[model samples]
Target: MKKPSTDVLYQEESTYVDMLLRKSWSMRIAETVAFVLGMMILAQFFPSNDTTFKVLAFAIAIAVVGLAPFLYKATMRPVYKLTKTHLIVSISGKETSYPLSEVEQVYEGRHFYRLGGKKESLMVSRQFLSHLNERLFYYHKGNKRR
Candidate 1:
């Protein structure tokens, strides 16, 4: 489908998950502090003379630190902009547009509203769309099932 040039009727600044993702730096620092404290506790259980235990603990710590950034990226949610005819999502500085006609379903979940399509789905937190919730709710009401 061709991209729509319409202005956004509603926009979500950031979802709860996205807020968490944006705090990755703080999370990583906390993780590192916890890892150090955990290692200190584990050190008492394993004797200093045990080379194998020391090597294993060191390896695991390294792996955890190395994978932290990737885990943060995986948890990020895209920014969402909803227009009359399309939904635009921006992830990692890239924008993708999907026609609203392709949206198969809209449902309110416990923490977020889910918009599902044939190949893609978006989870929109209520907190992020607090200002435009009423408008979005009414607009998608017809698309929702009983």
Candidate 2:
């Protein structure tokens, strides 16, 4: 088989926050079930007045939907990008170039890349990566030795 092109390999952005926030296959199902059950429970407690029931149900419905996006963002995975000119990190928009004699390593972690150096390190996530290539990433970072 032909070697996978570096350009193709690094096209997608995988944010830690995104992944974490995604309702798990099971969680989505559970949420649906809970919504139904909660509605039923609340309905039983509803005032005999139809208006009161409608208002309470509407409020609960709105609150659940409103919180979904925030919950997803909080739990979702972070993001990063690897391009030829520079390694663009998502969280902070930091980009580091390759070929620099100083950068000691590049490795994947749970939600970010660890770029090691004698003095400090650079960490990037999916949010930082943009459309680019590995060569461009190296060139942008000053073409330092890998």
Candidate 3:
């Protein structure tokens, strides 16, 4: 298939996010689950004759809960954009554009497209799945690789 140039990919307007709609609410809920599990695990050690283990677990759980929000804030969310010829991913503002010709497969995950081979895969949300199918169908059909 034909490859798109870097210039065209970088200049494209389409940007999509893999993040769920609830945003922070969803993330916090997941983190809260971890906090509950950690507390349960700590509870197992509470009855132990060894006091140090209990104290350590308690301290660790508290520390994790306290730092959870800050850690989530510090984490970098990758940005994805689809151009006429390339799949672009940006993390911490650094953009890397991959030619759409390299997309060997389109359907993998439910909410995201696993764009790349086993060595390293970029996850772009399925928001562009329909357009991507439209763009790449000709290439795949031309070569009978679909």
Candidate 4:
């Protein structure tokens, strides 16, 4: 057996929101279900105006298809990997590595921790909240000793 090279300090599984954002099939399925239910309701109330209902349904379907990519990109969830020397963020199929030394601020919130740096900010989800706190303490303590 081969030993793993990199040590993973903390890992979080994909959340429900992450799945909805990252998976195209999930999003399309959800949109289709919603569209069908909406059309059914519209048909029930406005049965006489078949043209209006059909036009509305068609327009909504087009909008859903057009906006799918945008929604997926906008709501992308970053997978966080906290290591000894760096924080790895995977979002939209890209992995970005940030050195721990560059972390300027760690803001603790009720649900998440905002790790801010010079270039960008990363949100550490609640699943890794405790690990985030521990890392923040270690970083700040090292700074104080210097």
Candidate 5:
């Protein structure tokens, strides 16, 4: 009934999966230390006297530790722009736009909201909660008359 606003209201690029996996900086340090230590300890069971075996194990451990974040980040589905009229969902690199007027269900969460339409759903940051609620409320209210 109304023209969709083009101005971006609240935009966040972080993904729902990332929010779940992201740890505090200090916690990350601890985990990394633990992994390295665990790998080195496991290396102890090799039953070999040569120091090269221990060095090889250390190298493998470091490689695994370094590559882990990159591996996880590659699969993160990013939630793109949140505008007054549209929410963009991005998986890989493709973007899909969902109209706010079509929103049918809102699954609110602690840090994110799962906005569901008739055929699809997308996760968004809590920063858009107020705007989403106001818009969804009015959208549903208007639909009730028909």
Candidate 6:
């Protein structure tokens, strides 16, 4: 018996997840600008005569500004993939995959597609869904290998 051909389905969320893992250039720019402004303001208010104190203040400002977007992206990345044989779901580095044959049922559940049966449910963002009619047609068209 020949195995069915497999294809992966991914939505923009996967790319966004990859981008989040990388970095946001716009956010980097914003942070740099904000940090510089913040350091200038701090120096003005603190009236620091010592060069060391001024440097420390600037360092602190940069750290605070830079930390925000990094944390935001880390916490909010969306990751999901649908393949011919399995569905991969991931967020914040935690991931899991489910075989299609193991999926006893699949349907819309809140903000995602839920696949469940055999005691556990897997949540997948609907964005990874292929065209419903096309997916159905191909999925049903495949012959099961015995």
Scored by CA lDDT, what does every candidate get? 0.58, 0.44, 0.54, 0.60, 0.56, 0.52
Please report the TM-score between candidate 4 and the true structure: 0.46
lDDT of each residue in 16-63, candidate 5, tens digit only: 344435433443575577677766776677654668767867776676
Where does candidate 4 stray beyond 4 Å? 1-5, 17-77, 110-124, 143-146
- Clashes per prediction? 0, 43, 0, 0, 0, 0
lDDT of 1 by residue, 1-146 (tens): 47675778677746445444334345558668867876777787888679866886787687666655446456554577877666677867688776654543433433233334343334455554443354455556765312
Question: Residue 140 CA error for candidate 3 (Å)?
Answer: 3.2
> Where is model 4 poorest over a 10-residue stretch in terms of lDDT?
110-119
Q: After superposition, how far is residue 100 of candidate 5 from its true place, in Å?
A: 1.2
Rate residue 110 of model 3 by lDDT. Answer: 36
Q: Would you give me the overall lDDT of model 3?
A: 0.54
Tens digit of per-residue lDDT, candidate 6, span 22-124: 3445545666777777778777767688877678886877576657545655675546566666655565677666655544333343222334443332222
TM-score: model 2 vs. ground truth: 0.36
What's the lDDT for residue 58 in model 4?
Answer: 86
Question: 12-31, model 4: which lDDT tens digit per residue?
Answer: 64554444334444566878
Worst 10 residues of 2 by lDDT: 118-127
Q: Candidate 6: lDDT of 138?
A: 59
Top candidate, metric lDDT: 4
Residues 43-134 of candidate 2: C-alpha lDDT, one tens digit per residue:
79876468978887777776665554455435543244453333433432333343223233333333223343423222233333322323
Evaluated at residue 117, the lDDT of candidate 6 is 46
- Cα-based lDDT at residue 54, candidate 3: 68
On a 0 to 100 scale, what is the lDDT of residue 101 in model 3? Answer: 65
Candidate 3 on 1-146: residue-level lDDT in tens? 46554443222222223332213344557667887787678768676556876687777767765666445435654555666667676655777666766664533543334356533333333445555665566655664332
Angstrom error at residue 143, model 2: 22
Residue 95 lDDT (model 3): 77
Ranked candidates, highest lDDT first: 4, 1, 5, 3, 6, 2
Q: Which stretches of candidate 5 lie over 4 Å from their true place?
A: 1-4, 15-18, 21-72, 75-77, 106-123, 141-146
Query: What is the TM-score of each predicted model, taking all chains together?
Result: 0.43, 0.36, 0.46, 0.46, 0.45, 0.36
Q: Which structure is stronger by TM-score: 1 or 5?
A: 5
